[model samples]
Target chain A: MALGTDYAQQDCSLARALEVVGERWSMLIVRDAFYGVRRFNDFLAHLDIPRAVLTGRLRSLVAAGVLDKEPYQQSPVRYGYGLTSAGRELWLPIYALARWGERHASDGGARTVFSHATCGTRLDIVGSCPTCCVLVAPEDVMMRPGPGALTELRQDPVSRALGRPHRLLAPIEPLSETVGEQAAEPVG
Target chain B: MALGTDYAQQDCSLARALEVVGERWSMLIVRDAFYGVRRFNDFLAHLDIPRAVLTGRLRSLVAAGVLDKEPYQQSPVRYGYGLTSAGRELWLPIYALARWGERHASDGGARTVFSHATCGTRLDIVGSCPTCCVLVAPEDVMMRPGPGALTELRQDPVSRALGRPHRLLAPIEPLSETVGEQAAEPVG
Candidate 1:
């Protein structure tokens, strides 16, 4: 709660939650992981964070039990970061907050619309499947651009891949290392 | 979004939402508003924020339409901040995120518990009343110290008032000016 304290002094659960994800780019990093961006390179390409900050966030998330760091490649020892079961519980808050943004944050337009993967019915304001009348888990949800979708706003490989309709939590295979470098390269 | 960017460059609603409330202390300010701590002194007493920082957050929240700045005392012209409709919608995310913390962030015990003011049924993970089978709005929710609550952690008047069961959005009348100063005094 203090300028230097990580809100540890507050005896509130919200304070505890914010201590974990309230860092500048931490929530966005968690959002990226939910979008199935597992590799560090892919997250870097999709987000505009510096490499060092991204590294710290990933390490912190892993340490907090929100993300699991696993090796996906042996030739170069590449690592993939995915949400743990506890981390996956974060989907509710993430979706609820993101949907709040969709309704009130931007102009009266939706950028990404979420739907029930099984029935294809769009979720309600709180991520509940109106047709099924139950809250839909992230794995059972699907995402795609909506009325405010800007396909060309970002040309990064991860962004391009995200422009398509995809099931939440399913890994979006990151492009090859060469293509990834090209996308991450400074445009200037 | 870029580092300098308030996530304005992103086409997503989540980015827009973050732009308004992602700054440190913003969400906590809003949380206090939901708990009926409206006056500047009450907020200052409840939160461990510097005076200038709290002032800035209040102004920004007013500019963003999350809080309304209204004159409550006219002799010296004191103002009170209350949540607007848009701000009230934040309860979904705030409550959900806090529940997530109660589950994963702390030692398996809840510091605070929320329930439907009408039925007294505890809210589900998503802020839904299991008995009523509907999402409980902020005004309909009641908060109380749970089994894990540490009542002595904070003795501020605002915190003491919050220690008792209270409804969301009802004002917690602040102590008189002299009592406020006594509580705000720095300990030797």
Candidate 2:
């Protein structure tokens, strides 16, 4: 599909998605939080990100509800960051990408292997039945749009993604029919 | 475990992973490319990223072998991008993260949906068995150092990740191995 213009000018679902989480360091911060790195210092130590960048990312994430900032200690103590339910849920995508990078990006030697904690069999992020050994493809899945989608924003990207074929990480279906027509209109 | 240091500087797998793809807009750029976005202007239209930023990101992705740049049309002599075998493999992690985001970040009402072209069922990125409906957890997965790992690079992140307990998104195994050694050193 052709990339349309005025992405910033449009209020579309993908755009909305990008607006919140698309900035630099956002996902990494979320990824670090999931790995049990709870403090700002831990994020810095783990990410090699500049302090300003980390701080900005953290603030944005908290504002976006991806993270919950709580006080871990008091007096001379400090606040620790943790994933809210929202943050915790990002595990799948992070794992999926990490597994992909490990499998494809490495220099031909196995860089890392993922195993099933229970079965002891190496796990595949996109595998079907470790026993049956089927690989899952995007077209095999469906997706439904989420809440942050524009109420009155309908644009090409959203239309094409919603109506036609696109490579999605998983299967998604639009949950709300009300979103269809109303979302297509331009939002002030 | 801690959050306040240069993680990239430390001997950590997550840090190394970040070094490769941790910069802002990188993964998303990869994601859009997979969605079939091919041109510079298209990415800008789709991502709302600054033109310079888009150029830089695309260049980095190409350099990393995550994307390939070729001429889409010779009339205007415009270039287009497509995934190499290496790029397509990123689907694993992209799916993982998208699933995580949809489950955790999405409100109960789906804003959109994805249909697996293979299964004909709406699939979640959770690595669950559709037939059995079992959810797979990170603890359920394990990673063994792979072939690409450079044993000669004693301080490599992959080496460190293989050495410790880490989630798919963030590898924390190096802390005890690397930091423990640091802690043991004489504190002059």
Candidate 3:
């Protein structure tokens, strides 16, 4: 992808941030991680990316300290990837961009809605709770599919599992082994 | 850069946002726009990007409604690109990402410091003023070169002009026509 030139000769902090997370599939993977899709199989099922690409993104994220890869099961050495503190800090930028898209880019309305988990009030454009008058932390935010979500476009088990309301950063249970295997095929 | 595949099958708002501004030099252009870089020659001088790439990015941003190109001079039909309301909405995400970079990516401290223009208090990590106890809008924020700024690396007139504190979104004067012609040469 010629990602190496992501920010050539730019001495700005934004350029540095982009250098780490600006790759094609990188931010989506981080988004999935925030959605609690920890395991490789879950990320593979939820995102339409090649396995090698996903692996490479995950490796880069881990190396950059955005995600931590740790053994979840030792029998065959399965690892789970989760957001680090640095990664959790990305929630604001991610949410801000998503809200901007919902306002400007989408005719389908909000595909997903984020709210203050405690008060159940939808977050403002900047990820703040209007009712509480404070910025909602990602951990304190809950997400649910909104009316604009295209359910028909997604059939993977992870998508189905995400239909219900979920808190950001809470681990998602793996889909059944049968469903996982069936959805393992990568889509271009 | 194979940027074509950035949002291949992604149906999320973040993906939509990235699709528009995720190219190699797009966000930096947007950042420069926020810093009052309206003239083409000023953008060319401030950003170390190829002239063709900068032109392409500016055209795309204008098409995407993030920027508006307007005639600033009638004699030569010269136009300046300014951020639209939708583009100004990007301040939160841009500031958030830059703050994150300053926190985690840079060892040289903040290259630039953002402050509340009204009270002159530096903004918090979330771009809110601690003294004002409110979120500072982009226009109300001021930026100044910080101790860690690498002024030596940039000799562009825009860089020199930015050395003094300036309010975000205030128009910056272009270099003299002769200097503009001299600095028009693309730098690698």
Candidate 4:
């Protein structure tokens, strides 16, 4: 569907915003950033995306100011990507859409569970902690695979690292240097 | 940019959700439905979308059960599209995304202002009525043009109808049968 990239002359903010992040794989890239996948290779590995496509999405995101790239490894000049404050603001929509997906598109269970990091309470559908009685920001949320998570499909280190609870926005520390990209075995 | 229509193996609820609504004009079409757009011509006029493209999107949405199609005119058997229960659930993501767009995509001011119909208070970025201390549902919300609205871009009846404060999800009644699809003049 060669629907043009921009919703030109729409006179709508959602249309304008869609021009920025509505491209395919763009929102998923943002979701990976929230899940702590930072390096270009990690995103490529976990998302099964074409390397050039990943490169373009990252470049577009950085240009849109939704992401900021900085040098993490100086030897080869490797850059790591992280959400800017503006990008972080996307958490609400991400959560809402994910929750909607879980409700309508799921095979039956949560793939990952999110909780308030402060008190360890699961967030409600609208993203408020029932126990804390407050909205849980992505930075303060902890994530782990849930019962409905398909544990057998992927074996990437980034996917393995997400198998356990981790803080949102924190860089995912791979299990070990010895564990190759496909070293991890499927637990299912 | 031939990103395939589906995320083949990504294991996330968000990924599953994106497969359904992440297409180029899919979300915008859904947004239009929420804004009380029904009938084929109205969507075509209001959206500036190709007729064939509109037909495919509406079909896809209906197949996914995000929208329901029914006959509103018996003589010609013309169909009207509206959000299903599952479709109405998309309000959260739409609101969240639109709010994000209002924050980041705007040139300067709001193009449309959303408010809680009960108290008449503008909704917060998260779609909550601060006055009522509750999340405002689409059925109970009202929408009207705002300071930044570019009134001159299009003069279709749907656009003209949206100019006034109106309730979300109610079928938009065209001003008159005499108003041809392009009968109205630009507000600017």
Candidates' interface RMSDs, in order? Answer: 1.5, 15.0, 1.3, 1.1
The segments of candidate 3 whose C-alpha lies over 4 angstroms from its true place after superposition are A1-8, A175-188, B1-8, B175-188
> Which segments of candidate 1 are over 4 A away from where they belong?
A1-5, A174-188, B1-5, B174-188
Q: State each model's TM-score restricted to chain B.
A: 0.88, 0.60, 0.89, 0.91
Q: Which should have the higher DockQ, number 1 or number 3?
A: 3
Tens digits of per-residue lDDT for model 4 on A1-188?
Answer: 33436788688888878887899889999999999888988999999898998999999999999999998778779889999999999999999999898889888689888899999998988788999888888999999898889877888878888877889999884553455465556465
| Greater-DockQ candidate between 1 and 4 | 4
Going through the candidates in order, the fraction of native interface contacts each one reproduces equals: 0.70, 0.24, 0.56, 0.82
TM-score of 2: 0.54
Name the runs in model 4 displaced over 4 angstroms. A1-4, A174-188, B1-4, B176-188
- Per-candidate RMSD, Å: 4.9, 23.9, 5.1, 3.4
Colliding residue pairs in candidate 3: none
Order the candidate numbers by TM-score, best to worst.
4, 1, 3, 2
Name the better of 3 and 4 by DockQ: 4
| Candidate 3 per-residue lDDT over residues B1-188, each given as its tens digit | 35533564666888888878777778889999899889988888888777998888899899999999999889879899999999998898899889888887777899899999999999987788999898899999999988778877777767766777878998876443343333444335
Residue B147, model 3, lDDT: 76
* TM-score between predicted and true chain B, model 2: 0.60
Preferred candidate (TM-score higher): 1 or 3: 1
